[model samples]
Target: MTETPSREHRPEPLWAQAAELISEQITRDGLTPGSRLPTERDLCARFGISRVTLRKALGHLLDRGLVTSSHGRGWFVATPSTVREWPNDLESFTTTARRKGLVARSEVLEQLVRPATLDEADALAVPAGTPLLVLERVRFLGDVRMALDHAVLPAALAPGLADVDFTAASLFEELTARGVVLDRSETAIESRIAGEALAAKLHLSAGEPILLLDQTIYDADNRPILLSTVEYSGDRYRLRTTFRPR
Candidate 1:
């Protein structure tokens, strides 16, 4: 009987070969993320291939998450978003954005001090009616809107928080300056559909799938200090972790 060939033994297709050449060119040309690639006609001529073959090559890159397509605008290099936390690393949004060579930004939506409700008090292990600070922001990576962040904490723990402008600031850094360094976080993730108002803010259509990350961050004393919630576009975020078997 004739033997079937394994995937590893198969010859690379022309489209895949084109993809490799294009990937190398992206680096050689110094096209950073959000930069548009050369037009399809130019790529076709340079690769000596038909438009169909060039499209196939581009499609490969799209599947690899290396590029994104804008309607009527062609393909652009894409920077992956960081909505998922690194296991055991209490990294902040600005930290992750810097690591990815992107510009991080925030638009403050709401910030206020209010008395803690029973549920909020229970979550932070504080007594009811305790004064708490609440903040809501739209977070961005590069020029793309990435996630919406909302956080709550005891007002006394972070003084002058209301006076700080969050648009160009990092809450983690600000908290550290106030002597409230976060030590760890207990996180949970869930999937949900984006409703009308939420969709408008994120530039997504209603009913789009979104990822919700709910977490409570603690200090070195093991006391929960911040209750945070983030909503991420489904295609833009991924949570990763590792478990060591005992």
Candidate 2:
């Protein structure tokens, strides 16, 4: 007699199926940055799931930086964090970085709020005592440690960040879903001496040459969302760009 196929052998989870459907909608609709998703009732009806089940699927997408919701606005596909230049546009950091044949990943070293420093206060346009969530990460390319970065975000703005899988996606993508649109950014690059943290994270010896970068990112309302200072191994990465004056 032939044995019946077991339910345990099903290829995907219930929530996963729902997540896939929602993901497809975002792609098919060409959802842009700051686009809002349908309401919970709508998604539930569309996916033929109960409210509890729909929320479960939405939670999964949220953790993956794929969707976001506000108190009254409902959910929306996250706006992508991207950079564009003529013939050279990078829509996502991890995707673009990987396309350059480099391995890219992020570790959520820290994800809690701490009091901002004077510098941080000025950069974020907040008071010195304002609470901020800090994220420290090491970036690698082809088995070589490339950069060490530290990012700070307004604690109140990104309440769900602590639940994100930093190892899997870009922080900017996650922030946008939560309503923090990265409207503009400012960057400063210079050479610097490596510190103990940088030395350890990048596996470099002391007194080595390194590249230092200070980057500030702002929301659509012109409020600072993240402030980061990065240190790159002198021998590992290069910055190259061409410009045509207007």
Against the hidden reference, what TM-scores do the models get? 0.74, 0.58
lDDT of 1 by residue, 112-209 (tens): 99999999999999999999999999988756777889999999998999889999798999999899979999998899998888877876678878
Off by over 4 Å in 2: 1-92, 243-246
After superposition on all C-alphas, the RMSD of every candidate to the true structure, in Å, is 7.2, 18.6
Q: Using alpha carbons, what is the TM-score of model 1? A: 0.74
lDDT string for model 2 (50-93, tens) is 78877988999877767755444477654232211112321345
**How many clashes in each structure?**
0, 1
lDDT of 1: 0.82
Number of the top lDDT candidate: 1
Task: Rate residue 117 of model 2 by lDDT.
Answer: 92
lDDT scores of the candidates, listed in order? 0.82, 0.68
